[model samples]
Target: MTGPVRHLHLTELRARVLSEDPAALEAWEALTNHLANVKRAREKGPRGFEKYYEACRQGLHRLSLLAGIKGISLYTSRHQFAADSKRAGHSHPQTAAEMGHASDRTAVTHYGRRVQGRPGTPLPLPSPEEVKTVRKKLGPSNGPHREQK
Candidate 1:
């Protein structure tokens, strides 16, 4: 397997969806095509990228939409927030708090509750019954094949 794909930039993203310029390089075209397969068009769905559950190639590209909306790449925002918080002297305690919460398996639960009120995060986590139903549908053979053979 290869490394985690580095996210793309706004200019790279724009050059992709709006591939009208003929002077664009071959590398750009290749990268854009790869993105097209991984990242669904914004016109398609709101997730920015659809997560495929199979091979590594079948992955999501959430940064595209996030960068577009935030007017800055996710990494930049992450760094910016860290820098700001550090300057404000709130970074250490905040990081520790987040780390403490990280161990809680109720991870997305709190997150979902927050945005459940908004149009965002419409689908809350599946209930136990819902999970059972999905398991029955897939059957044991169709389970995630992550075991070392």
Candidate 2:
């Protein structure tokens, strides 16, 4: 939760969150709090809290990186992006996430494989019996059907 920037073991984490950048600081605060809670709750052994906590940590890291790169926190940058997108003609979009300029379409895809051991069911390899029909369809190389030969 505490990054290389230092200033950990704060006298009060919640208070620090209030004074810091909301989006970036809040994310790290959430991650730190979730970790603390999970550590204490683990006596029951991985009751699905780990995944949610991990998501929080990932979100925090993402927001922090974006904030550092853009010299703006996620909260402000998102607002600015939205305002710009709306002015550029995406005014009535339902979610703020949907507000993007025409040329600024962003696509996110989770390209996971669908193999047997994979997340989705995988297709089986063709058996010898399956390919026997392929040869029949084309016929023999020197057969009557092979007119060019």
Candidate 3:
């Protein structure tokens, strides 16, 4: 098979792929062998990328089931990973790049949650008096502008 190529600097993942470690090397070999079998299956049939993707999804589902983890899906795992990365003190741009987001905004808006306070805590609204005072300060300009007669 081919030598391991450097993709990212994930220390744990990298350690598991290097040939210097016998157990890790064996695990990597088994993974590569399985992938090769999948590639051979693709070459022998009309199955393409979609089939490979579905197979991966099925495998993940089976693993989750075996682990007794309920409500874990691909999307949920992605969201969790993004949140975990953020919590681990990674910057927005760094997390976005790692997650393959087009921009940092995507990572913040979709994956990241508000860091302050408890999640789902209702924000306090302005009191009636406060609302009236603000409205009074705004005056007649609150509505759409009208042409002066």
Candidate 4:
């Protein structure tokens, strides 16, 4: 649900429902929209919504088992989405926004694996002597007693 549900998924569901009865579009749409309980359930509480979500998850698991698919779950799907986004030449920030991440760092750290052996420029580090020279120049004049003097 993070990304748009695959069109194939919707197509398959529509096919399955129509196979049972040709005139089930309204019924299918009702189910898809959860219109049956939408208004009434809001007044009741979120327990009904939670129960529906769990049932859908269980159904997905059962369907995966029936199809002989292993290791297909929400996490794997999300990981694949992130990996695919990276492969498609999207920047970390773009991928992060598409995947609903708050920060690009999360996308980079978790999903953006750097290509090994890629050459890059290294940042220059100042030498110890340079640091000491800077400290000496900034030290005595900036000291507390200098203000009094």
Candidate 5:
């Protein structure tokens, strides 16, 4: 784990940087070190990370345009992480904890729905007899409004 990092709203948020290549971690360390030592590059306002956040947003926007990928943003990573976690068989609570949510409801309601192909048993389809029975009980439909005999 690395040192404490600040979020956009100047709140403390713990984040784990995962990378397959050692060079990526090395670069991240170097960037953090550089930022720590240097004077504020932008205006006096905004926490250091916030300034960088804007820069990243602009840079990513330009890069996405060039690559012809629409709607790419920083939050995309978060969504992807949630989806990946779910597909990897993580429980809702586990994913919620990792994502810094207070309860599993947020993770299950929002993040959990992001998994493209959800795991677990498929819902059982009603048999033809059951379908007929239900249809008979409901009677014939007259659009949205039911007719009174």
Candidate 6:
């Protein structure tokens, strides 16, 4: 990621997203190209970035609903990424750098936990029917709620 990030002024971070899946890289490249064109056009201005981000957020929400997850926002991915980095044995400073923090305090304080055994792996979503059955067992409310108290 290059350019001025929200944190730490106009400093460029050294972190790069890597994946063994070629399709993931291809998709990222395509998005990068599109974003470049949008920047060049300078038509949308500040709203252009927001428009694309909202589209991505909505896409993720739809995908989560399809997978039987009630809510999964873009911020949730940031938390997951931080935890995954820690689980993968990254140091506090490394995690902070990847997260674009000037210090490790924010990364260590907020995201990730001390875990044992091997690193965590992604799990496939439960079947839709299974989700339906679980929801049924939880009653019409679906599950617990803070407002219930």
Top-TM-score structure, candidate number: 6
lDDT of 4 at 13: 40
lDDT of 2 by residue, 1-149 (tens): 22121112333334545768575476666768866876666654666566655665667668878777544333443454334333333212111123221111220111111121122111122223322322122222221111112
Looking at model 5, the pairs that clash are: none
What stretches of model 1 exceed 4 Å from their correct place?
A: 1-72, 96-149
The regions of model 3 sitting more than 4 angstroms off are: 1-7, 11-47, 66-68, 112-149
Q: Across residues 1-149, which tens digit of lDDT does each residue of candidate 5 receive?
A: 12222122211111222633465456557657656643464346546656777787898999999999999997776666666555655544444455555444554456524335334311122233322322122233321211122
lDDT of each: 0.32, 0.35, 0.50, 0.47, 0.48, 0.50
RMSD of each: 18.2, 23.1, 17.8, 20.2, 17.0, 15.8
TM-scores of the candidates are: 0.20, 0.21, 0.47, 0.43, 0.48, 0.51
Tens digits of per-residue lDDT, candidate 4, 117-136, equal: 11221111223332232212
Instruction: Give candidate 1's error at residue 120 in angstroms.
Output: 30
Residue-by-residue lDDT tens digits, candidate 3, 41-137: 6786776645775777888889899999977676775676566555555545554455654345555557635342133221122233322322121
lDDT of 2: 0.35
Worst 10 residues of 3 by lDDT: 135-144
The parts of candidate 5 lying over 4 Å away from their true place are 1-46, 112-114, 117-149
Point out the higher-scoring one by lDDT: 1 or 6: 6
Regions more than 4 Å wrong, model 2: 1-19, 46-149
